[model samples]
Target: MVLLYDWSDKHKEGVTLMNSPVHASDLPDNQFDIGIVGAGMVGSALACGLARANYRVVVFDRQRPPPFDPQSQPGIRVSALSLASQKMLADYGAWQYIEAMRRCPYRRLAVWEKSAPRLPLPKLGGHRGTLFNCKDIHTPELGSIVENNLTHLALHKAMESLPGITSMCPANLEDLNFSPDTATLTLTQHPPVTMKLVIGADGALSQVRKWANIDFSSDQYEQQAMVITVEYAGKQQDITWQEFTPTGPLAFLPLPDVAGKHYASLVWYNTADNIDRLMKLGESQLIGQIWQHYPDCLPAVTGIVDRGRFPLIKRHAQTYFSKRAVLVGDAAHTINPLAGQGVNLGFQDVMALVAILSRDGKPLADPGEAVHLRRYESERRPLNGQMMLAMDLFYHAFSNNHTPLKLLRYLGLNLADKLPFAKQQVLQYATGIKSPPRWLFR
Candidate 1:
């Protein structure tokens, strides 16, 4: 029988339960209630949530996050966390750690199309772009920009503090087998563990999904993205902006000040070969290239700290669950990063799954029951699919040079800029303050 504790009222109090040693004679025949693969942001966050509800959770990851250093330069991998995501972290007690470490919050967001040859159309004075302000939506700030490593570390710390969670790091899943009532996971460095439910929080190339025999479809985008961490010659700014070109988008995201110096993360989207050429350039050469090609509004870049590149791909599993196994986060779906909703969608998955398993603060007797897993899939799959479609639309529309589509783009941005209701709705949706209605999913 699964062990359950009523943690609803005492969740704020830190709890501790030592994990059983690999060869401990007292170890239960079935040690864990839930087995989670991948302990990154999504997986760790899920572990924290379930543990808070007093579920015996075991998490497996191949590697551990490096210890954070206050003096180190920001990592090239960063994410813009929407308000909804922040709330989820705060609820799990991880946001406090993130705030104590480092984060940069932006109150405004701007997007515009770069100037190019235009067909005869009404020209708007100044830049034809939509600027979204937090005040417009009655929110204090839009979202916070955080280093991916810091977020992972914060969630990892929170997971460690929860008594109900057992973390197995440097442990690789050697094999997975599902019986009638439970799933067994064989790890390279640890004894096999059994659980009533197994979840795949692994990334796009999910081993759990593969082991479960779940099929997914993926499409590679024509453009690749290169991210550069740099210091700017000014104070920290409260805004993030993106300029769209026929090739791809040029985006600037503010990072927290380091040693009283302002820093920002820049993203340049282009063809794979072009990104490779940019990546090969020296620091000074790349800085010069930024000044030559980027929009005039970009601040003077003083020095480059680090840079990396990734190919864009959209993937979705054909189904979220197979038998006793289920998928979440990137294991379920991945969208174009044009809108920065990838992780927020993952957090949403965590919330929905947790809510289903721990209904009304009462842990289910069998968390892996097919009916409960189906409900979790039913709640998240459509929303993820919808967001994927929306990102695809933006990716295609902004990356095209068609004259007619260009005019439409200009008009859409202009209308979004001028219309109060439309702008507010768009802002709320983008910031994750609002979600699409159920009727739209019909």
Candidate 2:
């Protein structure tokens, strides 16, 4: 037995939703055109986009992001948002809030392999490594390094400002059921709500994917990543760099200045046991280790703010849709964070799905129609697969001490450095400026 509410057609204007739980019985109607689970960066952005397209949207999450505080230390988690993703955020009206808060813009990206002691060659210089300048591609900057929570907060603001969005936070989905035309969501704190389409933007551990009976395959990598937030003894940097060693890559992403102090995030990839050992070290000891192993490009570390670690895993769903439900973002696929393209790929998923749904200048009469769902899956699956494969290749090729592969990598880096046209093309692809077949947009 299920309960249904008489949904209203009139849109509510100037409604600002809070993070508190809302009982289904208290609403004008419990039904919505779309119900989204997981109000993270991707989920919140999807809710805002769908609402802007005139679809009534309800978003559910177990918790809400804490309010942003400028006085607080920088978070260890951040994402390098590419140009294409930036445009999408701007289109959804969230970029304004992000800019108003804080963001670090980087104009150059550098990649190089550190020489092994066993090798016959001397260490490489900055000139020997491949550097990508935004000037070469005629862009002011390659991307912006933003805190994940800040992006989520901005999108939440954007969603609250919209007329057709209902945000249900501090709420969890107890159960989900599907019918021929709609899906029913059972909440732990609120009554059951039904919608034409249910989006599983929850994340890698998506319960929606499980309830929909969708199966996915995943593979864990040999190396795990440890991220550290630190203050550097210098001004804010405009360039980000990564140095590949036999263990893994050590990377740096700049963060905005806090109270005139320069801040940055560092990623150290190594075996799980090694990362655990490193995590056990005192802040001073860890900073000493970083200075000993990291490249010469790293500035002096003033202090350590925070640190954390996560295993690298590759996951992809067998299919992106089942019955009345569809998947997006980490719910559908998760690739390597080597190039920092994970969030950008999720934003691309949002763009493709929203475009497919509103192709006829308006959303389809049935947002959950099988044809529309299949089209969305078709557009995203192969592209995501390609990116995953590329990352795996990069991981394997650079994580070994093989002599021939080392020579090849050395040659490849120098070759990429010398070829202006090739560098530009790679830059465009990396920055998410490259588009799918134009027909997909039409």
Model 2 lDDT tens row, 205-319? 8999999999999999999999999999966799999999999999999999988899999999999999999999998999999999998889999899999998999999999
**Which portions of model 2 show Cα errors greater than 4 Å?**
1-26, 116-126, 436-442
- Encode model 1's per-residue lDDT on 1-442: one tens digit a residue: 1222222223235433222234344345546799999989999999989988778898877666777789988888999999999999999989999999899999999999996446676765565899999999999999999999999999988886788777766465789999989999986535788999999999899999999999999999999999999999966799999999888999999999977888999999999999989999999999999998899888899999999998999999999999889999999998899988889999999999999999677678899899999999999999999889988899999988888888899888877888889899888888878886677666
Cα-based lDDT at residue 322, candidate 1 = 91
Q: How large an RMSD does model 2 have?
A: 5.6
| CA shift of 186, model 1, Å | 0.9
Candidate 1: list runs displaced more than 4 Å: 1-30, 120-126
TM-score versus the correct structure, for each prediction: 0.93, 0.92
Best by TM-score: 1
